[model samples]
Target chain A: MFFDEFKSWQKELTHYSFEQVSQGDVERALGHERLDFMDFLALLSPAAKLYLEPMAQKAHRLTLQNFGKSILLFTPLYLANFCSNQCVYCSYNIKNKILRRKLSLAEVEVEGKAIAEKGLQHLLLLTGESRQASSPEYIADCTRILRPYFASLGIEVYPLETQEYRELYAAGIDTLTIYQEVYDEDIYASVHLAGPKRIHRYRLEAPERACEAGFSGVTIGALLGLGEWRKEAFFTGLHASYLQKTYPDVEIVVSAPRMRPHAGSYKPQYPITDAELVQILLAYRLFMPRGGITLSTRESAPMRDALLPLGITKLSAGSLTSVGGYAESTETGSAQFEVSDERSVEEVVAMLRSKGYQPVFCDWVNLRDRRGA
Target chain B: MQQVNCELLNDPFEIGGQKLRSRLFTGTGKFSSHELVPQIIEASGTQVVTMALRRLDWRNPQENILNYIPKGITLLPNTSGARTAEEAIRIARLAKAAGCGNWIKIEVIQDQRYLLPDNPETLIAAEQLVKEGFVVLPYMSPDLGTARRLESVGAAAVMPLGAPIGSNRGLQTRELIRILIEEISLPIIVDAGIGRPSEAAEALEMGAAAVLVNTAIATADQPLEMAHAFRLAVEAGRSAYLAGLGARRDQAEASSPLTGFLREE
Candidate 1:
């Protein structure tokens, strides 16, 4: 349903001359209490780069006002690196000659315990898109095993049917995060050459389906380096706003992750510098003041720390992108992508404290299982 | 300035088995600094303060919000993000486990525009939380029927909004709140939208059991002074209510005899 809406906006967005987004547009967007999609585009334009300082200040104040001086900390547990997709940017692309592995139920528990021992209660389970290895049934089983150890469980796997999402929710999953990778359908098709991920419309509608299945929260994002950063950011903002309006009960989180080096030797066609990334994050904060904005370990330590006060409400700490990496200490299998910030969970926590932020671990409780208790 | 020499107001009240001296309840949101909370509570003489439930910090587990709160003040953990009864119940259980005791402010609001509390969902949450042994104080829109339902569901108190949350519009639903104050047997604590001290005093004068003030004080230039002002206002209003207001008349009544003035003679 939203695909049509997105297409119409996309067509209109392409026609707007980027030079027309003047300083006046930026100033007007900043003055309004509520920002619209056009305001977002204006903020993302090059003309608005001069107003970065003021934008950052507003973002900082708004974040502090809404979320307080707290950062929600979660670690992604790479459940498996197996895949059937042929995405150009990822290391786990099926055509690449790499080691493939998926953790057994026992291994999942071991990794879960390892993270729990660090006093973390929120976890995001990641896996490559492969039905044979990382199927919905298998993912739900992993959720069942780790539900007791973690307070909140999120999944970032392949897209699924509405009924499948419902099954995962019944198995103790609290959130579903599905990034479109890139919003431009043409760019998306070129990158994801072969796989179910090539179906752009299906992936675009995953979050809505997840909401239909009754997820408490859903996170969406776009990889910044693949397409034009401005266009990608605009579409990402549009998508998040739509989901936010459609499902008021669900928490819609948006992330702007930069492309990282992986097995596939593909460089970004439209690279986003650190400054541009900062502008994008600030635009997201100004547009959706109450929505959750996340920053992953894909960014460098200094970069993540600098952007923390700007608008980031969630961060992944001590993340490993490989399956069974946490339990064994050594690299057990292929990683989806190389992690930039290799700090331990403790180090990240200490960094948060040094920055005067309180790292939050367990923000949600599972009531579905304890309905009568 | 002329001093009124008003009598000291000392009407103690009880909610959820806790005896409270101050009828003013404060919140731990929108403050420029958390350190200001203790000072404000002390200045206002408020015995109850509310905080929302969020994720615990893993790095510094020892550094807790409860540390900032004084020993005797009652900590009310609000279910601010919950949109359904199940979610509220979950947050309440987790809050109790986090050592906040059993007090919970059920705020089930799904509307993002005005942030109005959802009455039906709030009523459901209050019923469930009460059954789960929580001291449930549900925030709701000022509707007589919903207030009666919350009371029937065993809510410890019914907190009806004076206006939409954080609006600072002050008693836009005054007539409905008056009806609730008149009919509901439970304590009618006016929860949100009271921006000024005079508004808090007005709610008290209208027979509200207590008033919860957050944005008015927290967003002020001097929170401590504002807290002190609210304390005095609540006391004055409660005293006036207890002392009983004079009946209204259709026409002006003279304090001195109209026929015995020296100028007239």
Candidate 2:
């Protein structure tokens, strides 16, 4: 029904004026009139490619204007490395020779404390797809222990059921990030040869499940190097739009984590250039200004820095790809993937400040405490 | 010389039935630390602060975000994470139990990309809460039509986004907000989408009763200083509006005697 409805809507939209939304109007919401869906499509066309630089400038100005010279920084903690899937491109594929490890409850706590001590209030928990090893119970347990330590808790592990997500949200999970890896279902299936991740539809709907389960925020992304970069970016934008329309209350965050150096022979089929990445980010900003665009530590520091003001908002700083990084007591020493920006949290904060962006540590204040009456 | 006092700058402003000595309504997300919040709020001369329920501990009173705020400041708990009427109501109940029942900043955002408030959910939540005797101030799009409906449904005030929340694009919806002010008798607070003091000033100049900002101030290099700037901007904008802006003309009209002065000289 939705597909049919969308098709009709698309047809009807073709008859409407799909004029370009000027960059100035887009950024400042000034003289440029409000755009219909068709106009938005035109604003993101190949013809729109020439206008990317200006769009980025407008996005930068708007970003600074709304968010000021500030950036939200966080770090990811890979709690478990065990995987049930045999993904071709991943370092943690089930058939890979790399050592697999999962942090015990105590180990996770140690890492959590180290992250907090390092001045990070937000943490993203990552785990490979292994229900037996890292069950819903295990993930929720980690969340419960870490809830008091951080202001924001995000999970980028295996996709779970709606009820499972609801439990996690109830356990104080603030954000749920699930990357589709690639939007092409054929490529998605071929890449994840085995395991639960082979199911493209399930992973595709993971974000929706999270939203349905009442998570505050859901992050969607595509691994850029997996398929045609432009096609994937376009699809990623479309996915964001769909989720935004379907679930209005949930915060939508879009991330683009291009394939970096990995152990597998599966090289990048299509490498997205830094400028192209900027174009994608700018397009997103022009199309959806308020959406949170995250830049992982996969990109170079300079690139991340340059992109930060363009359209990116939330970021991961001083992230560790291996389990028990914070504890510094890793039985399995090697990491899943190499980090590009290895700067410490303090250094990242200093950089942001040097760039004139205010680094906000905390802002949540309850009304009951404010008013005695 | 008249003794000019900037301390008078800290004087309170009343909107609806609530009295706010400080005009800033800080957002909870997109910051660096929770430890630095009270200090930043203190420095900003803010008496009213906003928080998202999802970001707080409602079940544990001590762990609740309410316990973290400094004394004498008013806490305006917002339904930030709620996506549906059911969720908003449930969160509102939890908030009430956690001690902020009478006042709620009802934000029912359906679009995560823009964080634009869902009019249907806002109306539903407001209606339900108003009957329950909750003082609901709904965050809405800059649509006067919706504001009137909310007002009719007994909303304390209508807060329309100047732009999308946290986009920092200021007064993007300036025209619509202007219409809201003209059409609605209730206080119109320009909430969200304000990126700088200038944007806040612009809103104030356009006759916004108050402006709610979080990202612009909290994300600044010095949040306290940014807060001060916003305070001044709000005052300036409000003062300018009250002073009466002259009508705009398509062509320039000379302030001085344009025709004869130069020629005669």
lDDT digits (tens) for residues B1-265 of candidate 1: 9654444455777788877778999998998876888898999989999999777688877555677899978999999998887898899999999889899999988998889899999988888888889998999999888887898889889999998888889999999898788667788999999999999999998889999999999999899999999999998788876755543321232333211211221
Query: Residue by residue across A263-357, what tens digits does model 1's lDDT show?
Result: 87899999987778888999999999999999999988977888888889999998988887787643477888889999999999999999799
Q: Pick the candidate with the highest TM-score.
A: 1
Model 1 segments more than 4 A misplaced: A329-331, A370-373, B1-265
- For B1-265, candidate 2 gives per-residue lDDT tens digits of 9864655455456655667755556665565677667766766666677887765355664454566688877677889888998788888888888876478889887788877889988999999988988888899887756776798899988899888878889888888898788557677888988999998888877877788888997788977687778877877887776554542322232233212211322
Q: Residue B9 deviation, candidate 1, in Å?
A: 59
Off by over 4 Å in 2: A1-45, A363-373, B1-265
Retained true contacts (fraction), each candidate: 0.00, 0.00
Which residue pairs show backbone clashes in model 1? Answer: none
The alpha-carbon deviation from the true structure for residue A178 of candidate 2, after best TM-score superposition, in angstroms, is: 0.7
* TM of each candidate vs. truth: 0.61, 0.57
